[model samples]
Target: MSTIYKSEAGASEIQRRYREALRAWPVPAEHIHVPTRQGETFVIASGPEQAPPVLLLHGSGANATMWRNDVTTWSRHFRVYAVDLIGEPGLSAPSRPPLDSDAYALWLDDVLEALAITSAPIVGISLGGWMALDYATRRPDRVTRLALMCPGGVGRTKSAWLFKAVLLRLFGRRGIRRSARSVAGLEKLQDQSVLDDLVLTFTQFKPRPAQLPRFSGDALRRLTLPMQVTVGDRDALFDSADTAQRIRQCVPHATVRLLPGVGHSIFDQTDSILAFLRA
Candidate 1:
């Protein structure tokens, strides 16, 4: 059942109906106030508790709902936990002690610990992916398997668009709605409604993490855990093959896949993600 007991859709809407919208949705979620330091709350949603645990993290400027379209399908086989990154929009709170990239990784680790997710499969996309890799490098024992989708921090990313976001955020949160509209209406974004819904709910974003630092390439090599990496062929970030190679050099045992015509957003490559995780 969704922690969100009430909905604008209708209070009388059967639990199943809301679940239908939220259950197999692109951005299906509810408002949960999970406790953190200083009585703060963090919002998160998931597929089911009975399945194998898989925590889903979104990229910067995105939220857990980005996985809504993919979660139900993936959750059928693995328990999927989509988190509203604390210090971000959605139901999370106490967006304080502003951080850098490594700090972001520690914050994630702290959230999982608070959630009691001691050890589990973690799949991160973009910044989330970078966090996952950084976490694994820092404490490989805590993660069983790792999956990174067009993760950031591999090298200089070609995100001239992100600069627009920086400028708009400085202007104020109101600009985000317009930004969200622009993001949702893009031709590549087929599920405009899902992205639209996500953009509408981005109440706050964590203060920016610091510029990319030289992360622990040596630490990443020592982990023997299975790894899978993917990026879109047309991704604006890194060119496909080089994207995989750079990550592969960090962990030679990793398997890398490229999606033709796909971009940086792994949520866009829903089917392939489900297939790889299920395998």
Candidate 2:
């Protein structure tokens, strides 16, 4: 499979840091590899074997370890599977599937099948949220509940801002840090190690140069599963108001929350998210 890193050395360094982060995960977990039509999928499984299943998906430029803060609590009540999305900076295969195709849904199906999970609740962040939404639209039967945090695809992305951010990144570390803050609307990152890893990935890794495909109103309407959506009012990518408005308009039964003063990162709302999952 094709790799996403710019060089073999860069890929190795990022993998090393990722492994270090995984070692610090609060809960005991098992790493598993499942073969899929697209590629090999990596997953971090935790919690009791008999507990109800909950699938967790991380955002772009991230891996399963992004759930470190939430996993400890979440694993207590449910069997948690944090999946490393294919083609990203994770242990998963480096196969970049077409965003406009059903490849992601199919890959997810393979993951569930390998784990022997018929149906379960799914929680996703940013691009991962978009992936979960895409899968739910294609196979609603496999998703019992869906929760999205600052998900893409619900509203149009601001291409001009993204372009500016990319240009800023080319200047150097300061420029990259500025771009990161602009995209996330955060003055300071909660975790320094996560920020360091993200910086390395952005500077050294070769990311897929593709934007998320917007979901049509008809597609959103077909998502009948119980759903909860949350976005930051200050999100720099998509218009938060438009995102919530679209979900409310298309999915009438869906619940939406707009966090004030928040940005792209939604890790702080773990308590409420856990409550939603339990409910």
TM-score of each predicted structure versus truth: 0.71, 0.96
Which portions of model 1 miss their true places by more than 4 Å? 1-32, 37-43, 94-102, 159-186, 194-209, 237-241
Candidate 1 C-alpha lDDT tens digits along 1-279: 222222433223332232444445553444455555423545455556666778777776555656666765776777677766654434454353433445655676666776668887788887678677777777777888887787766645666656665566565656775555443333356655555444444432233545534345676567688888887776654556766767678778888887776766554556766666667
CA displacement after TM-score superposition, residue 266 of candidate 2 (Å): 1.6
Pairs that collide in candidate 1 are: 26-68, 26-69
Candidate 2 lands at a TM-score of: 0.96
User: lDDT, candidate 2, residue 215?
Assistant: 95
Which lDDT values do the candidates have, in the order given?
A: 0.61, 0.89
Task: Give the distance in Å from residue 240's predicted Cα in candidate 1 to where it truly belongs.
Answer: 4.7
